[model samples]
Target chain A: MEQFDNVSVSKRANVYFDGLCVSYTVTLADGTRKTVGVIQPSKLVFNTGAPEVMELVEGECRVVLPGESEAKTFKGGESFSIPGNSSFNIEVVSALHYVCHYG
Target chain B: MEQFDNVSVSKRANVYFDGLCVSYTVTLADGTRKTVGVIQPSKLVFNTGAPEVMELVEGECRVVLPGESEAKTFKGGESFSIPGNSSFNIEVVSALHYVCHYG
Candidate 1:
């Protein structure tokens, strides 16, 4: 029940690695778009344009907030937040499946 | 990549048990839409509106065609096709993650 069945998509892309890591995007209902991202076994930095919520839907990864020194590991069902115009780093232990919410 | 990063969804729903199983919809680029379906450990009879390609993204399941008696087991990376206005039966062994394509 964490996802919807009546979802519609207008645009789509695959394996966007112009940045540090690779990820994909899916726009959900109400014009709400999200990135169902997957990170390989590597480290990457990402800057957000809007305040975003990172939801771990599958697999796991380690994340470091903008002001944090210690990176924390997150598994499925866990989530973190990043303010707009902010940046964060992630260390993918294995393959990670995540949904990035834009607001 | 099997999925797109620029995907968009305009409408969404969840756990549609009004049918034989539960599934969700997402519209992708080029006005393409798909159902991220999850089948429980049960047998289900489903009728298709259009020609559909059932892609098993996770877990495993057994499928029986309209005129077939022997069910076939399919795992991740496997797929099957159903003609439009046709009905097929599925026997889910575990939780199955699938992307149902319509054409």
Candidate 2:
């Protein structure tokens, strides 16, 4: 039988992007772990192969997709997805905390 | 030209789920908005139709799928995706913050 434990978020490390700091942690079956803070725009677009990814921001939400040719807005507490292999831009208009995951 | 503004997160409303609180907001193209806090499990499964969805938890990440019969784990700052039309369960085992978005 295999037993695994849950990973905890570290207080010292939190991901900061735009102007927001998103909290997160990574845990593996063997109990290995790591902490990360702040996901940068370059990283967001880097190797964009995963099906999910998230960025946190503070204040208002402004989303501009070059292909869409239109800006879509989002409110705090509202979550949306940015499709894979698409070029898009996002900014944290205010102060907000967002957590994202990809498959 | 159609002008749209970004949405902000309300200090009063923060979404809580399982044992963790998720920060988010929903902004529209027309500026209509609402504040929400804490996403319940029933609600996570209620809509059930979207390309992406996310959940946050504190401590070690433990993912269990009945179909696969395997448990996958995640660390803080590590994001993954949950495919559309899949059944799953998550718990915020610690005092942590997590944000989830769906499209």
lDDT of each: 0.66, 0.40
Clashes of each: 28, 46
Cα-based TM-score, every candidate: 0.50, 0.32
lDDT of 2 at B53: 42
Could you give candidate 1's per-residue lDDT for residues B30-96 as a string of tens digits?
A: 6687766555567778888899999887668899987788999998788999999999988888666
Candidate 1, residue B21: Cα displacement in angstroms equals: 3.3
Model 2 per-residue lDDT tens digits across residues B3-51: 1123333322242332233433434335444222232222222223454
- Interface RMSD, all candidates in order, equals 11.5, 18.1
lDDT (tens digit, per residue) of candidate 1 on A1-103 = 4443344332222333332233434544566766654555577887889999988766678899989999999987889999999999988785565677888
Chain B of candidate 2 vs. true chain B, TM: 0.49
Top-scoring candidate (DockQ): 1
- Docking quality category of candidate 1 according to DockQ thresholds: incorrect
DockQ, candidate no. 2:
0.02
Q: Which regions in candidate 2 have their CA more than 4 angstroms from the true location?
A: A1-7, A10-23, A26-47, A53-59, B1-103
Q: At residue A14, give the lDDT of candidate 2.
A: 44
